[model samples]
Target: MTAAVAQSLSSLLQRTTIEDHEAVLKSCNAVLAKSKSDTRAQHVKAVALLKLDRYEDCLRVFEDAGDALKQSAGLEYAYALYKCGKPEDAITIVSQLGAGRGAQHLEAQAAYRAERFHRTAEIYEDLREEHVSMSNEENDLRINSWAADAQLQWKGQSDSVHHTKATRDDLEAFETAFNAACLSLAKGEFGQAEILLTRAKELCRTSEDLTAEDKEAELVPILVQQLYVLNKQGKQAEAQALLEEISISNISDLSTKKITQNNVILTQQTSPNPYVLYKALNASPTPVDNDKLFEFQNNILVGNTHTADLLVRKYDGIIRSTSKALSQSPCPSVSPSVNLLAVYNAAAHAQGQTGALALKAICPLLERRPKDLGLALTAVQLYASTGNTTAAIHTLEAFLRGLEESISEDDKDARFNPGLLSVLVSLYKREGRTAHIRSELAKAAAHWRDRSEPCISLLQAAGTSLLHSSDRADLEMAGTLFRSLHQRQADDLFATAGYVASQAVINYASIENQVDQLPSVSDLVADVDVDALEQTGILPSPGSVAAAAAVIAGARGKRPAAPGDEKSAKRVRKSRLPKEYDPAKTPDPERWLPLRDRSTYRPKGRKGKQRAADRMQGGVVSEKVEEVATTVKSSGGGGGGGQKKKKKGKR
Candidate 1:
């Protein structure tokens, strides 16, 4: 604690600034053991330990110095805390440092590590504002801004990447191109991703700004992404070849091993393995011919439609395609394999024809497999998708006639929840067929009213559908259903909304004495939290809840319309709907479906364009890979994080 001892400790720290870290650490420890009360000695020891990259041991030294070290040794202490997995602690220290890019950058990294992606993005955005209005740029500010945008996209938010225009030479900038490639891959634009990755590869090899050590950090990641894009494009052979060339030391982002395993599975193993050579007979437990279905599904995921069509033919052979397989399937004993459904659906979707027009593609299948629910449901889906609701309902009703229940607990093959039935209920709700729900589906609806999550979600969907009904009794019916569902689970978002909406409508119509039912709703508004509803992109904000309540209160003060004040129409009102067409004469599709699907029909112009955009919005992923595909590993901070230079390791 004396002047001489503190001066000696400062001299020991000076050795750390040179290449004498180990010697300084040894000397500082010796000095601190003798001068246990000297905070200056503790500071010197922390410096030497940090310089030696011993972050864990450095923490003990800093703990002794504590607040005394905050002013002078804050940067190194915070960096050490971040390196030692104390990012939140590092964030607090960074905040105390006040105003500097280094502190802000450290906090950004800490927030990213905490998985606070939105906060990480905000910090990067603040750093990038000066660069926003320019184009053809290759600076850290712009690059980190795009990187942060990619992180947000991975977190399932809409991407707000500030894409500066890229000149041709800009493609050779490895960092920019690499990030752009990830954005493309996430968007399901494999061809564009591949192009950007190729540019990234060229720049990794030749960028003059990089030194020998830096190239290694960037090489493996680019190659790994390339192998993935190639696999998605159905170039299995090329993906296998590229995967052989990639030698990662500690990488885990790309599913390199899984992709390689799939390639190995499909490489004509007929003699060694017969799984790929035959159509699976079993529908459950495991897909008997999973390898083929996996490959087929992968093709469908990337919209390699032509390849998927070829795969369907290759899977079942041309004669044993979906129609033929269903024809041979033993009805009621078991359904035709799901492999055929995938094959036929892909073939049908590629043609842009569903329902009966799609029937030309597989009419014989329906005739042959009359008892197969899978094929029947496929037909119903096609009918529904193409506005052939009349056909869908007719087909579904006839299919349900022989079955005793919508879900059979005794039959393993029978459904537990209603995907197939919900479609029907949806159709019924649309056509204002309250009798169909009341008289026909009452038992089935009661059966599924409390079964599982899927059942609950569909019931909510049904309630929402009825809430939009033109009939006042239907609104009351919807309100009753939603009230029961909300009471069961107060946190159920759609259930709560439906109950509040119904109460709002019913209260609006009631006289003052009937307003006692409003308190339950008032309590619900105070307690329920459905903020997640805003992210669905389907539901409007519940700001409408307050608006509806306000309107209802205002309406209570007004006089009701009398018979004399209710004027009759001077001219007969024309129907706002499209003129109904005859199905027998014009091949019109809507007559068979419940009215809702028909009402959604838009003439194929701007509606078609918007639908296409929505499909491609968050990137169209098929079901299976969606469970498996990971986004590009995000690193924190703006582009100033030193470029990871990956050398092409010994091939």
Candidate 2:
């Protein structure tokens, strides 16, 4: 292919990303159309195909491009093989490309896939100094992941050679200490690693016969480790001393190395620093080391009055120190500017300047990193703390809107972070701007209905906040929000509980208002017709009308007058008992009747008449008396002492 076609194809490829696989393929095909025999065009086509995930077609394209272009297209070809499930072949292909960054990355990936972690580490280490630089945050993240994996696999395998090498010279000592420190750092033993690296520095300093070249070569690694440790230990002055010692020629190189190491720490997502300096200072008035105080004064943190007090007491002027740090970095980078703003704001606030003064100082930094959530949140907080709540809210709103607008239409559903939304909602609630909060929350909730956890949590927090608000309308809105949340996520305990609580509050409020408006008991009962109410089912029917009547009558505290009770009524009115009344006397003649014969009625049968007759005679007849009489007669010969005796007996 001619230079023009090659340039066109290269320009096209430059504009393509993983998200535009079709565009890549189209551009590559257009190049291939003009240069059917061009191996470069064929290679581009294969790469585009690979990115498009047409693995078999990609491999075929590579094969058709012939073995001559394999050296040039090795990474793409190997990547295709890996995608096609031939990792061993991919590994072999990548290994044959000598010392290139792409080859090293590809080989590391292949080795990683093949579980050859040691080989992966070796490849990454080879790429560490040459083609790889740490300025690229994404690349840094990738390297850290690969390195962490390698470190995990190589854990507990500390070679004896490394120990022996540490005794040799400064560079050797530094390397040994760095390696051990890296491992120790990986395991979270910061103190032990600090001790080792500090010793490594001492060894470098006391080396007897080292040449200038050796010293220069060893200086960086020792400096890097020392600086990292000092930063970790919050020893900024010592770190500054080490920084001052670095030659300007090596500053870029040292920064790259530091970023690389810092990336490793970041991938663990742990803030390994002892304390967020500002937070520690804010929490107490305790004095920190000069190094830490320097960091705070230089705007690396939002220092408190405590830090200012310490700085004033020690160095005599914190504001002057911070301004000096700012002047030192005139063409300020993002990181330095962030620190500068933080310290400037903190110092100004300490001196009793309005929050607006501090905020104005950092407005440039805010504009530069509009999408930086941390910086944006910090600015919002500073604005809020200084009583400029409206400004804080507007800043957060702009930040969140920028984040939304920056997302591609394809990723708009998935990519939104809820943290900004949460901060904004919190600000709104703080300012009592509840009306804006719900609408913003609804938009966020709908956008993050399925993907983002932070958004969901924000909605939950907003709903809970609304539920507890003093306004009844806000509380009702809370029930609606939580009900929607519960419908979407039925198992969310907070949403479910919030919804229930809101409903309870609403019901209680309604009932309380009704209670205040209700009439007194007499007035209420006067309007009600009891018979009509029971018939209409508004009132329940009594289970026993007579018992209900009696209970009601007794509860009235007055006896109804009856014709027969006139005498008793007169006695009751007099508050005295009748003269003839006796406490223990029976009221009627039958009141003392025997238990077995109280009633005149008898159970029917022959026994009934007999029982009645016995009761009438006041005696009980027994069957045994009749049986004895009959037996005696029978024993005397049955018929009156015999028939002859019968006549005598009769007489």
Candidate 3:
């Protein structure tokens, strides 16, 4: 290949090997343009297009790539074939290819898709060495899991072949049912999964039927999956009940245990307790660690509103449990320190509590840890959440005052500056002290911009507060803040929406007149009658005519004429014509009348059909037709009118 083509191919390879499938496709197209017969370019192009989900286009390229391309890019060609729903053909091609990693992987996939599980299992076993050598652990894990599934499926199919046994062995039966259930659940066949899992559960109940290893390895995993399915299906109550029946400790030990079965060292790194906390907010048999709880809370910050609510509930539960424990004992579990009580109260207050008790709890802590910024912020936030804005401001102000004093003495901690500025910005924003807000916000932007999550949050909150203000200047300030936020985090939809809304508000305020100079709905739609619209072919049916009429009526009622508009002047001036009459044009009552309400009318929904009917004999029939044809013709085609027969021309 020429150097230019080689360079192009190298560029294309880089794009294709990583993400950026779009760039790869573009680069490949450019490469293919210069060298139409370039096999490598065509192959990469096909791969790129496949990634972009242009499956049919990719298949077409493969089919047209001729014999040379096919020989060189057999794996890609096979993959394209497989993607376009020709797995059998793909398998044939892959079978002929050399034992390349890509070829073997595609072959296994094709076999799996074709339900040739035995073949898939064989290919996976053959590829195991190469798979183990690969650096991608995630991909390796996936391949291993797929191989196991295929083997299980193949074994289950083989077991069902025996007709002699009325029932299969319990362990085998459980394995088969569990595998089927997992497949069903993955495919979203919840009903089938539920049935299979119930059977597995029954088998599991007979403790003597399976060994301890089988129970640990097989049955427990299936139960966890069953729990997941139940949770996903919103059968929370059933999930909770089933969860109580299972020993979480057993599942934990099973996961933590690294067992060597055969040559494969099976390993799993998961603790079911944290997952339980996530799925069931009130259900965690093990003690929830504070770090784990906080981590869980932080992860769910960007989750859906329901998940966020769950996190809040979890936090509230922890706080309440901690508080209840603190109240019951003379000395707390670790220490009866004021800081601990303050932290607990802050947590409770954060979960939307009154924080009256929390405020009381934090007072002593504030006195003890006067220099602790966290304790002070906690008190401020607790006060804020509990509608004690004055006290919150006062607490934050006192902290700021102390920091200023330390700064005068050249002993101010730089770490405390950002936190103090953020708190002051929030408090000033809440109190509508715009000057203070701007000052503190400027300081925060200079110090902590993009360096801190809390700073970003502070900016967002302040922006939102200013956005709600009626003052144009405040809105402009808000727009500036939100625009900065949008630039920093382009994916922040809330920031983007706020910016757009602020821009709209600013634009609307820019107009000199309060009302829009829009053309009136009546004028735009200009005296259009529903009946006339139907007759003149503007509307296709009476239903469409009725819909148009409804829309026009709604518009006319909602948007009254603007005071500065011509319609308003006409409305104010009385005309010489009587109320019921128009002198310039006669009004048609039928055309102007509102459409009849279709809802109140009983619809002729079903018509009885005639089973037996007489054939006409010279315009006379012994028996009449019991049912007439009720299918309606198009009203536009001169409704049921027979076409006039053309007179024969006299020759």
Candidate 4:
């Protein structure tokens, strides 16, 4: 080798050893400048790029260096894929690197991202058996094992995640508690979950190695998980108060931002309006996309219409490639393009990108799968997302009408997909088509026959909507629906609330209608049959019945109360004086006041501290401070004594 290349190789070794990635990059570049085929230079340069977190650049260098990227760089490659949200690809890459501590850890991490919770647990288990001693890695393995179990859903073996926690190093401890908290939360031990998350936050805050950015990145997720626990515990005030301590503005890192957003949505706070909660969440965000949709969304966000249009066609190619395979898959949710649609729609909304932008992606697939309810709903969402609600509603209605006539058994169940029905119902509601909602929900209620949760929910919704009507028939129907729902699901507060409201409306209407049928004051004497009342025992006796005719005749002394008089009773002004009050004598001071407001009312409420001297009701005289306290208490004097009955001063 030449002297210059030799010097460069020496410098690269020195810099690489000390982990000065930038310096290592320069030294590697120096060697590669002198001899283009220097493999060491290429490898060191790639390592520098990976260490700097220039993943794309590192990948490019890996491509150029071939096998020189080595095991660690291969691990970095998998991590880069994981970060890019291609967990399956990450797992594939990690699997290709054979097995070891790093490879197994990488595979487990990738599996976690892919939501292969069981696989993650298995990998952690293997690692645990091999290590056999306490270390940071062991803590991490234990934490992640529990974390994976948390998401194993029905397959989870145990709920004793809280007992698994043990002392660990700062970052390892934070991660442990954070993961354990997830298991706790999954088990519905929200109080325990909250404690774990708080512990995680403390570790993050006190971590010596982490920078402010790092602390914030770790701390925000802990706070967000804590917020979720608070919500689950119904401590809404504490959740809102918790929001104040988070500073999303300081979180410039996209991964952290994504974490925050995920937690915010997962928490499911009451408000549907994300913008109102944007700052409060410290995480409320427009859904972000990976490279596929990001290219299109970024173009739209920056007003690059021409590029966005060109990029929009990319979805067409993706649809053409994946739609057939994905349609055959059992789970529609796993469709890549369909899954990305939400992120695409959200990104477009944030930029106010209103148009039929979904046409490129949805049109071809929709045309091919015209009768597919999932596809049809996706099409509707596409139109709706692009600010074409009218088109969306029309599209949905046509699909529903067709499915209503289809001969296939699957079609029958497909039409009843709760999400599909919900979208249609919500669409109709938005358009203010009360009749449509009533018809649709009524059909769904009959179809499910209260055998399903969706049926019960739709029934309650239908009942609530019908309860708004003033018609007696509608009110009665609503009451019936609510009554049935209350019977079927007694614990459903919403159903119970709806039943109460509907019953109230029905009862009120009945009372009002009865009042409406009653005779008016002018017709009261003509309408009364005194002899009939006497025979029916409604009158006092036969003599009274004979007198009843005369009784009702002059019964209107000045004004007589008739049917529905209570409704109009407000027209009468009550006199403060009693009927026998003499004008010469003054009236009782509190006669005009309400019974509760009268001075004679002695309110019983929470007790306050009483002095020892005051506790002695015999009015014991005291000395010094006790005497002063007594004097002060007496000065305030008694209350509720009808304005302290005082003799009028002589004029």
TM-score on alpha carbons, each prediction: 0.41, 0.30, 0.29, 0.43
The per-model lDDT (C-alpha) reads: 0.60, 0.59, 0.58, 0.63
lDDT (tens digit, per residue) of candidate 3 on 599-618: 23333333311111122234
Best by lDDT: 4
* Model with the higher lDDT, candidate 2 or 3: 2
- Which residues of candidate 3, in runs, are more than 4 Å off? 1-236, 252-342, 345-361, 381-386, 400-436, 450-651
**lDDT-sorted candidate list, best first:** 4, 1, 2, 3
Q: How many residue pairs clash in each candidate?
A: 18, 3, 0, 0
Across 444-537, the per-residue lDDT of candidate 2 in tens digits comes to 6556555533345666766766665678877777777777777776666667667767777567663343343335579869978887765443
TM-score for predicted model 4 compared with the true structure = 0.43
Query: What are the per-residue Cα lDDT tens digits for candidate 4 across 1-651?
Result: 586766667565655565578878887777777777666667667668767878777667666666655454677767767666677988988888886688788888877766566677788888888855555676566667767776663233342222344455523578877877876776777888888788888888988989987887778768867876887788877877887777767766565554455445434456655443443433334443232223222233223222233243334433343455444554324233344443333333223333465455555655565565556666677687776788889988887777778786566666665557788888887778888777776666556655544445566666777777777777777767866776776566566566566666556653453344434667858878877765554545554544565455445343434657675365533475357867588778898798655757654543322343345468755466577887678767657464577789987
Residue 222 of model 4 has an lDDT of: 82
Which stretches of candidate 1 lie above 4 Å from their native place?
A: 1-3, 9-20, 23-27, 30-34, 37-41, 44-48, 70-72, 130-138, 164-172, 209-213, 248-651
Q: Between prediction 2 and prediction 4, which has the larger lDDT?
A: 4
The candidate, 1 or 3, that scores higher on TM-score is 1
lDDT of 4 at 170: 23
**lDDT measured at residue 295 in model 1 versus the true structure, 0 to 100:** 30
Clashing pairs in 3: none
lDDT score of residue 297 within candidate 3: 23
> Could you tell me the lDDT of residue 353 within candidate 2?
42
